[model samples]
Target: MRLVRAGRRAFTGNADVLADDDHRAQVTDYFADLVRPFGAGPVTDLSGQSYGEMAKALVAEVVPAAEPVDLLVLAFSIHDVWPGRATATYLSHVCPGTPMSFAVCDQGSASPFTGLRVIGDYGVRRALLVVVEQGALPYESAAATPLAHRGVAMLYEEGAGTRATEVRQYPDVVPEAVPELARRGVAELSTGHPGARVVLSDSLAAVWPDHPDHTRVPAGQPMTGVWWHLAGASEDAVLVGDYDRDLRYLCFAVVAADQSSVD
Candidate 1:
């Protein structure tokens, strides 16, 4: 499948549009009991963007109505404030073709890579991949939240003479072993694609082998960092990667520009 188009949006301030008395009470109670063991206080803030809302906006912008997708995948790491809602199911109804939609999460930043790989495995004629990150947490935690809300939507279709994406992931990759493993992965993915640009998440860049053309994704937006950069890449062939420190998964994808769609 080839990536034909992509679009992204960033949200700031309060996301109070979806907030309601019942939703807030439920979210507050759920988080309160969950964090009580850690001595964390009750959830006082429930202002955050709904993944459904964000993904819907992105779908409308990137995927044309005439070109209905066969599949839609939503990937995220941070929990949405509106947690109880079945976001992926909601998206399927709104998106064209009423595609088979689902969300991938709990694997940290590897979620998107996993989602992309799933789409390829499905052998669909067309697909949509939505990656999103939100910035709010009702209770305090060890994990860092995104600085802002962001979402990216990519349109992929079966076609020739377009940029194709191939995803690879390695699990339980400790920091000490990342350099060697990443170097080998990059080398394999870059083979025959001369001048392929390498884009790495900040954590990956620190341990990655020295490369003259590699670019580092900015910090703060862990889940969306690499994908956000991928949307803006101008290279004909590019390799984007990220290492999830908490989850210990190293994920990468090579986008081969001018390559025929891979079946």
Candidate 2:
């Protein structure tokens, strides 16, 4: 499948508009027990962007109404303020195709890569991949959170084009093994696509193989960093990659410009 269209948006302020009093109370109670052990109170402050709302805004700009998708995947790391809602199902109904949709999470930054792999493995005619990150937490831990709220939507479809998107992921990759593994992965991905530009996450850049054509995404957006850059990439062939230190996952996606649209 080839990436046909892509768009992204950054969200600000709280998502209180999306939730009601009952919804907020339920979420607060749900996390009350979990935060007690940390000496933290229940999450009464619901100040984060809703994934459902963020995805809808992106879909509006990226996915065309005439070209409905068969699959919709939402990938996220940070929990949404309105977690009680079934966001994926809601998106499926609002999206043009009424496609089968689901959310992928607890995979750190690799969630989007995993979602893309699923789409390719399923051989769907058209699919929409939504990657989102919010900047709020009910209970605080040592884990890294997004500096800001952001989301990216990419529309992929089967087309008569030589440039197809490919996803690669390696699990249980320790820091010591990153340089070599990353080198091989990049070389393999760049074999056919000449002059492939490499976009690396901040963490990956520290251990990545030195490439003259590489650009490092700003830190703090663990889930959406690489994808945010991918949306604006100008290169015909670009390799977006990141290392999820918490999950020990090394993931990469090779996306090339849609040749069908080229004159």
Candidate 3:
């Protein structure tokens, strides 16, 4: 059965959000510009906080609506990273995918997990994340979906090891491309709505990773997922900010066969 493609944008890892400077506007303004094009459908904007509360509101706003596709993006500050699980839950339950895109703000003084490493055996292959720092954000999804932060994503690893930076902890969810989840646990619907394929990516660059000088990764390895890149299918582009250290966040762009070059 074809399902809708869900994506997300979060400010959980944005160091700028937590900055004491009066640039809080960056957090608010960026969000506004990002979501301006994407009319509300199945997206969660973690601008301020109370994501739990936000979830409840989203349910009320978009429930029993045919599982609409979900797209997330955020330029976070401080309240998001410490409890990375919040964003994880939002992504895991709300939007399904491994190595999900993540844009975190790290100023070398603060960490998303607040002194704890979010290295919970989870791999980026499960979901590709992209972190952009001091760089402007894109304004479109690779799938051509109307979203904030368009264009390509740059990869980097900044502040690999430092006393000021702290590692963080994440949820214990199995983030990989499984054929059918093999009934191992509950099967999450990648798309909140109905669609032939679903692609989730960030429209812009929103994270400043712990290691920003790392070499850029070309693309992400393929995993199990819905056929988001089918031929003759109306490309449903759901765009937002992808905030992970890996540049695979934009992998959602081209996964289908070359239409003109194929049978």
Candidate 4:
């Protein structure tokens, strides 16, 4: 799939009613406790923004082209379980005359990558992929990582815009495979853009090689991989990889918009 336009929004709005000052304080304490156990820094703030609101903000940032979107695909983290049809239903309202809508879940942090595959497989002329993480509240199993509210929306077309050259997954998810998988992924990326570097996920920061040409997206935001490669960084093509221990999945992709071809 090729990228047409991309927009990102980070919410710093009111804390969720459930995450009131007192509750947030408790969450902060828990966050600190998990820091030693989890080895990730505490997530400081929990945004109160609803998923629908953040989705709207993200879409508003994109200046739509003359072409109508053929499909809208929503991708989110496991922390967001608002409802089964919440996203499709809300987006249908926001996007009247919607052609089609769908949501990708159950892949956890890898849902966005799956959403990209959906765009490619659907063969749509134009599609929208929106991914958001509103800081998983301090539920029983949610406080292990730091928290932050961020959303990213990318428009894709079949043969136009920035091309996502390759999206693949490896079966190795053990801690030891991180460096080898990441190294191999980046090496594969270099086949096309020989000078290509990488943007490492925070999870593999410690094990990955000390490359002077890599950017490590911080731990908190789930979709940082997409945001960093598409909107933030200037790499001609970037290799983004993340490992999910529970699922034993290692997902990575190489995306480029600079008219470069994977020859």
lDDT of 2 by residue, 89-201 (tens): 99998898999999999999999999999888888899999999998887656666789999999888876645478888999999889888888888888887868888999
- lDDT by residue for model 3 (44-96), tens: 33322333333323333322343332322222332321232455345335533
The candidate that wins on TM-score is: 2
Worst 10 residues of 1 by lDDT: 254-263
> Model 1 over residues 113-230: C-alpha lDDT tens digits?
9999999899899999999999887787666788889999888887565447788799999988988888778877777566878889988887666643678888899989888877
Worst window of 10 by summed lDDT in candidate 4: 254-263
Cα RMSD (angstroms) for every candidate in the order listed: 3.1, 2.3, 18.2, 7.0
Model 3: how far residue 175 lies from native, Å: 23
Models ranked on lDDT: 2, 1, 4, 3
Give the true-structure RMSD of model 1: 3.1
Ranking by TM-score: 2, 1, 4, 3
Better of 3 and 4 by lDDT: 4
What C-alpha lDDT do the candidate models reach, one value each?
0.83, 0.83, 0.26, 0.64
Encode model 4's per-residue lDDT on 82-102: one tens digit a residue: 322376568756752364887
TM per model? 0.91, 0.92, 0.21, 0.74
Clashes of each: 0, 0, 65, 2
Higher-ranked by TM-score: 3 or 4: 4
